[model samples]
Target: MRDPYIFSRMHRIPGYLDPGDALILRALLGHQNASGYRGGAAEIGIYYGRSFFLIERQLRTDERALAIDLFDAGDQKSGRKRLESFTERARDMGCVLSEGQVIRADSRTLAPEDIIARIGRVRMFSIDGGHGLAHVRADADLAAATLSPEGVIVFDDFCNPEWPEVTAAILDFLRANWDRLRPFAVSQKKLYIAHTGIGAEYGAALDRAEGLRRLPRAPVNLFGHTALRVSHRLWQRIGYEILCRMGLGRMSAMLY
Candidate 1:
């Protein structure tokens, strides 16, 4: 079968993920999201499913995995779960489609009832939504409540320079729920592993997986240096942004 993440894996921009985020993702790939003992996997962000591709590599075709997103490329699954029930359709359609358990809705508005009714409790959940105080908080709440007790929550865009508000909300959440939301792994791209688990053995296995050993700086450097070679343009864009932020908007536009 054609790889779903081939384009993204080959073409994502550099500095898009830093050393820490790479480590976190590698470590999360080592175990069940809820805890070391739990089973199954599910992802919430389909920003093309970059992380989805990574985790799916660890599973088989028959593994019960769920992918939830607003597949809103003007595709068919582009509405709330409030409408077409996701499971019944999956069964009728023969459950062999490329997309797995597709839910077309903003996770903030996803109904927990449909989830429990359709796929049962999710083992691992990747929360990459809203990122605002209201939306991110609401999504996080739902993820926490819905995740299996031993499940893990993968948070995306933790250190987005363009969106400080999202950073603030995530930090506040970590502070407020310190015990449940331990910052196991972090980086410039902001992927953190939060284990809401109670098993000592499970926690140890995951804790061991969080490290910087997986980041090979060569790929990104070579890609930028020879392949796409977008570094020059990126530097220019950064300079222009600085100028704009410093009250030189007119000059910045000209420079850009």
Candidate 2:
């Protein structure tokens, strides 16, 4: 069996992930091997630090994490600044970052070579970066190039209309790279992976797509693995409206 560099303590984190996600996480942790792999994890976007805290709880001193984000301002500069501040405020709650853990940058420049020079090949790569076709495709390519054999690459906000490009690019990538990649888990909004396990998602291709669509929304795993990684604030606003009506509005939001 291949090693799966799993984290033991991350299951107890308070936000984002659900019981199902914890179960999946445990499976990842219980598969570690003595191979020379460092087996790391990352989050492309850290909006409020909830997911960062979760990852930090399971991280070792030697294991590195690359948190890619702008942190200052995007379309909603005020919101971005507030989120950046809130993330810093939540540091004391759990998995605190001291220094060098956070990389304040966009995912576009996060090339495969950067992974080599900075974080090395990872065991789990959580992508909540930009949702545009260009950004998602770039991250997918980077993950495809640098992910370890037994590693997992989870995409946040996989099939949202706001990021139509994300859905398009990922579906296209998975179809083309089915031999090396596979989709193992799907909630309502986010899609999880086990690599190679995705097999030929044939006979179940529509099922696969529909399954990915049915994944629990980000308010569930946004803090764990599946992020509400949308690039458009307009769509986010609408989603928030529905979530508010559904009573999931007042929470910390399982943001990526």
Candidate 3:
């Protein structure tokens, strides 16, 4: 089932997740839920709950979702305000941010146990906390440690030139833990990873997902692994261009 909240309301939230990546995530979450994969969902760096909200909406009432951020670590005043903004925005979307669900600390300081204690084993974990090499490595370790046997992790800005360290860190992590974790899919903005054995299962879900345009080209080679590449449809791109010319590019993107 398509999520009305995502198609109609997600654009209003501020963040960097591409629409194509969002579509891919929704399909993966659907596949996980349908296959009876039971575990919590989580995001390490939730900026205003944009991408995190997509994960949160997929959780069962019995499951928990954790938002770990350095909300006030840099500066108490600005941090507190940032946390408040996230909370208010979440509440407006009908999700009340409980004290237990929100962990206000640096991702680097957190051990896997700290996360497991709060949300148990995660089925869908997003690592967008920091773009620095050390930051990505630390967050990746935390995700791998707390991930369920068949869980998946989404890494943001994997190959963006603006953050070359993210790509380097992910490559190093993947090389060290290739047997444990394998990437399945790549969107314009995120890399979808899963347990090496079940990586194909998630990739199949994307292949079967509707409204997503897979590039006709062959799968991408990331290191020794292969991943399917997806992007917006041609019609969607044309619509986006039309909207851009009309000064409604954001709205067009949300709709297309």
TM-score of each: 0.58, 0.61, 0.88
* TM-score-sorted candidate list, best first: 3, 2, 1
lDDT of 1 at 220: 20
Over 1-256, each residue of candidate 2 has an lDDT whose tens digit, in order, gives: 1111112222222234432343233334333322233566677766664455445445566776667777765425354464456454556454455445667777777677777566667777777778888888888888777786667677776767777888888887777776667675554455666566432231133232221232232323422332232122344445544554565543313221
Winner on lDDT between 1 and 3 is: 3
Instruction: List candidate 2 segments past 4 Å from native.
Output: 1-27, 30-38, 74-87, 94-99, 197-256
What are the clashing pairs of model 1? Answer: 33-151, 33-152, 34-150, 34-151, 34-152, 35-150
Model 3 per-residue lDDT tens digits across residues 1-256: 4466555566666666655677778788888888999898889888778888888888888888999888763324455577777888888888856788999888999888888888899999999998899999999998999999879999999888999999999999999998789899887778889998999888877787764544332378877778887765677656745765566655664553
Candidate 2 vs candidate 3: the TM-score winner is 3
Writing each residue's lDDT as its tens digit, candidate 1 over 123-240 gives: 5667765566777766666766666655666666766777676777776776677667554443345544455444333334444443422232211221112111011234544654
Best by lDDT: 3
Q: What's the TM for model 2?
A: 0.61
Say which candidate scores most in TM-score: 3
Better of 1 and 2 by lDDT: 2
